[model samples]
Target: MTIPLADDVFRAPGVELFDFPPLWEGAPYWLTKPVVLAVGGALVVCALAWAAFARPTLVPRGMQNAGELVYLFVRDQVARPFLGKDAERWMPLLLSLFCLILLWNFIGVVPGLQFPVNAHIAFPIVFALVAYVIKIYLGIRHQGLAGYFKNLMFPPGLPKLLALTLYAPLELLYTFVTAPFTHAVRLFANMFAGHLLLAFFSAAGFWLLHEQPSLVGAPVGVLSVAVAVAMTAFEMFIQFLQAFLFTLLTAMYIGASLHPEH
Candidate 1:
């Protein structure tokens, strides 16, 4: 379910009286908030790339250092371990996914940008679809269609009956349904829940301060502020964790498809 922000939650006392419009109006066709956010996020990542690597340096500094650190982290921690000898070819894709997701997740923490792009299902869905297509493409490219189906549906050390009754259907479901669903929902749910908690505490604080103008209100506001601060820190950690988890899972899936024997 989509959580609603309180009327005054995102507003400062003397800010202009522009109402927060619904992200969509008609049949959700073109240029929704999430779409705009996603596009903006892509642009931000591209800009970062240009700033970081456009000018090569022997001793990387600033954006270059940050970008290289992220690249090495994803390359060493995610792709290499999973994809083994074939990792170098895929490192760029995984690095791009990691950075994009990290940026999208952290956008909520930026002032005046109150929502994480991944909290919207559409963003995750698009990413998951891309991952799925890559997986299928890799599988088909490496193994012929016959072998791909064999690897997908028929595992080693399984009896023929068991393979037919259990493994085949399970693999089909995972390949066709569960994998993408979980991949998309994992990121979506994390951001959605984190944002909801932040909104709740922030709004609660405001409501307490405004609705109850007594000594009690001050304490409640203070408590709410504390919780908001705590949740912000927690959300920061979660933002990174979700990006790492998504990239790691994608790497693992790619690894499995590329090397099904292992």
Candidate 2:
């Protein structure tokens, strides 16, 4: 439940904030803000990537410089740590994931497009499922179908009896069920909660100052605005962190599939 403000008449924003109507009056049910934002974010990411990396200069400047910074960060912090020699091979996927997700998240704070694409569960689910499918496919292809399951469920050094009775079931659950579920939900939950908090404070400030202005309400309204501002800054950091973590986890999943013993 949302924490109601001190006043009873003023309603704090709730789940309704996330309930976006169709973009057009007679549009299909799926044609909503998040859908549009997700597509738009993807295009923007592509455009930026092209602008930055499509051309090269010995002394990089402008977008290329910034792009290199982001690329190097993903390579060093996310891919290299987990993937080792294979990091470059996976940079394309990892870079796209990080850039697309970071843009989707930053869109939440944009004035007109304040909806984060991943705040909707479906967006994250799609991304997570794609990554999950890739991980599974790579595991089976690289380590043969039976070998993949064997390495996953029965890691070496464990007693056969212990592996069969206890470790196997837990490994199966984590590998097939828990991993993908948490992968999507972690991103969804953070964006959902962050956007909700932002909307709540923003609405509260507006309602107090503009909708129901009063001597007492004005100061509270100002405070609410201050909090919203602070949270917006903090949320940007969280947005970047979430993107990094998501990409990192993707690398880790691929690494585990490629080298199960590690």
Candidate 3:
């Protein structure tokens, strides 16, 4: 959404947080700032990966050092506990997912690129769809078709007769339906709400002082700006956490898919 900057100090700033127009008159229906940011974020990840690993050395330096920290963070925190010895097998996927998501979310705080791509439902849905497909494919490959459904719909923890009648449909519904819905919505919803909140406070800051027409609201405007700045910091931490969680959940889903019976 475009911030309505007041031309005059006494004019009210608009707070339209969810409305955006096409970047250009001739642009395609899907072309918008968020789409550009999503593509840009992906390119940034590729460039960073290339810079880090393009010319490998025995001793890490510059971007490689930073990249290694990120790689190890994902490998240790995201992969090892979930995949165990298979961790290294999937390091490439997990690491890429983590970095891509982190960059996507981190763009929200960047000066010129304040929009988070994941705020657009399409972006998160695409990633979730990929993960969902991978999950089902892995499950079928490892457990066999019938075994996969059996393991999923007929979990062993529940009583046999009760499980057949009660938990079976619930389990199927959760795995087949609710899981992916929540998966995409969680990221999209958070980014959507967060960006709106930041925009609201920022517009309030300008509106109170510029549009108030008196000194009475100046202090409130200052307070609004202060709160906006504070929320931005908190938003950064939340962005990181959300990226980590999305990757972590992806790993968990894949792991369960691969070992459904276990």
Best candidate, lDDT-wise?
2
Return the top candidate by TM-score: 2
Find the 10 residues in a row with the least total lDDT in model 3: 10-19
Runs in model 2 with CA error above 4 Å?
Answer: 1-8
lDDT winner between candidates 1 and 3 = 3
TM-score of 1: 0.88
lDDT of 2 by residue, 134-204 (tens): 99999999999999988988877899999999999998998899999999999999999999999889889
Residue 42 displacement (Å), model 1: 1.2
Per-candidate clashes, comma-separated? 0, 0, 0
Could you tell me which residue pairs clash in candidate 2?
A: none
List TM-score per model, in order.
0.88, 0.95, 0.93
Query: What is candidate 3's lDDT per residue for 1-262, written digit by digit as tens?
Result: 3456655553333324445668989888777787788888889999999999999899999999999999999999999878878889999998998888888988887887788888878888988999899999999999999999888877777788888898888888888899999999999899888888787788778778776545888888899899989999999888899999999999999889876654
User: How do the candidates rank by lDDT, highest first?
Assistant: 2, 3, 1
Residue-level error in angstroms, candidate 2, position 120: 0.6
**In model 3, where do residues sit more than 4 Å from their true spots?**
5-16
lDDT of 1 at 72: 84
What's the CA error at residue 250 for candidate 2, in Å? 0.4
Q: Which sections of candidate 1 miss by over 4 Å?
A: 1-29
The lDDT per prediction is 0.83, 0.91, 0.84
lDDT of 1 by residue, 98-182 (tens): 9999999998887787678898787889889999988998898888899999888887788889999988999899898999999
